[model samples]
Target: MKLRKKVDKVLGTALAIIMGVMVINVLWQVFTRFAMDTPSSFTDELARYLMIWVGVLGAAYISGKRLHVAIDLLPSRLNKKGQTKLKVVINWIIIVFCLAALVIGGLRLVYITFTLKQSSPALQIPLAVVYAIIPISGILMIYYKLSDIINKQL
Candidate 1:
């Protein structure tokens, strides 16, 4: 729990910064587009990339907080022991399928980005840098899932 809290704190701070930067970029883009004669082409692209990072990092925070959505129809009516067992099974399924897919898919995205030497049209920033968030988020999600299993089931 302590460690989870710490991870949340760190990720929360990072999310804040990323969101702030994204907002700033958007604001600048808006200002430049409307108020000034020339708008920055790169600002929009940069904001988009930052938004993806924000989403990925935010997911990690959600996982750490155990705030991910779960259906309550059955578990809410089940006995305590049954509920526990069901919850364990559901969580394991999530850990095995969802997290594993994230890892595999995310890594493939990173690899493709690297292989193509992809870059944003306006910003010229490496797309791989942005795509790297996928696997990193997957790892964080896995860590949080394991922690939840230990705290709740083990």
Candidate 2:
């Protein structure tokens, strides 16, 4: 639980910083484009990359808080015990999906990009680095789900 809290705090702080930088980057891009008559290619690309990171990390943070989207129709109709069992089942499904799709697929993507030495056109940064967030977030989500189950049992 302590580790989960720490991870959430760190990721949240990083997300905030990324969002701030994205805002500033957009403003600067606009200023340079209209006023200076020279659009900043770097800022646009950087903002997009930052946004991607923010989105993935933010999703993981939200997952930790159990705030992600869910269908409540069936649960709403169930009794307390039934609802609890349904929740555990749902959490297991989520864990399995995260492991197979996000973790495994994302790692394959990272490997492919890294092996090819692919780089972004504008930033010239390795594409693998950007793709790395997928597995990282997936792992974080797994951690959060496991923690939730443990906490519920305790």
Candidate 3:
């Protein structure tokens, strides 16, 4: 459990850093464009990539917390047993769909990136490097979901 908690902390710290980077990039771009009369091309691109990282990292964190959106309106109306069963079913579905999509899409992207050696236009960073977050976050999400399913749903 401590390991999982440590991972969560790391993810949280990463999320915070990503957000900070995005904010700083945006502000820096705005300042330069307005006050200094010149805008950096790479700043916006950097911010965009940071934002993508933030989104996927945030998704992994939220998955761990079981905070992703769900339709719970009908659950409250059900009996206790029914509610539990319904919740289990929903969680299972979520886990399956998310994990499956991650595997399929992630593999395809990785292969394409490997073949094409894609890189960002402005930043010159490998596109696959930026996109790697998707699979990593997906793996994290799957781990969290599996733990939750085993401990709570099963």
Candidate 4:
């Protein structure tokens, strides 16, 4: 789990930094609107995009940590062997979902946006850049789940 530790450290630090920036950006937006009597055009958009990254990346981090919320109704009632088998099944289902919905679909979206030359209005950054995290997080999730299964650490 050494690699897991490293990933956790990096992801936690990145999330903290992004959250700080998002807070600052919102504060600046508020300040500019109230004090300067004009809204800062980019802060709102930047915050929005940062939030998207934070949310998705946070999800991936939690998945790696096995901390994401789950009801566990059936697993809770099962014995150890049954629970382990169920967990493996659940993990496989999640892997397939992430592969299809997040990885493939996200890549398609990013490609389309890039091909269309779409850009955010306020930041003027390419839309593809913003959408890129989807597949990245998807890959990270796949890695984590595979590692967990291989190590039998769950």
Clash statistics: count for each candidate: 0, 0, 0, 0
Which candidate number maximizes lDDT?
4
Of candidates 4 and 3, the better by TM-score: 4
What is the TM-score of each predicted model, taking all chains together? 0.92, 0.95, 0.90, 0.97
Name model 4 segments beyond 4 Å from true.
Answer: none
Tens digit of lDDT per residue, candidate 4, span 59-98?
9999999999998899899999999999998888999999
Better of 2 and 4 by TM-score: 4
CA displacement after TM-score superposition, residue 55 of candidate 4 (Å): 0.5
Q: What lDDT is reached at residue 30 by model 1?
A: 94
Compared with the true structure, all predictions reach lDDT values of 0.83, 0.90, 0.83, 0.95
Q: Over the stretch 1-154, how does candidate 2's per-residue lDDT look in tens digits?
A: 7888799899889889989999999999999999999998899889889889999899999999888788799999999999889888888898999999889999999999999999999999999999999999999989888888888831
The TM-score measured for candidate 1 stands at 0.92
For candidate 2, what is the TM-score? 0.95
lDDT of 1 by residue, 1-154 (tens): 8888888888899999999898889999999999996998899889888988988788878877778776789988999998888877876886776566777888888889899999888878788888988888888888887887888832
Q: After superposition, how far is residue 53 of candidate 1 from its true place, in Å?
A: 1.4
Ranking by TM-score: 4, 2, 1, 3
**What lDDT score goes with residue 19 in model 1?**
90
Model 3 agreement with the true structure over 1-154: per-residue lDDT tens digits? 6767998999999999889888989999999999999988899899988988998889889888777787779998999988878877876786777677775687679779968998889999888888888778878887887777677742
What's the lDDT for residue 72 in model 2? Answer: 91
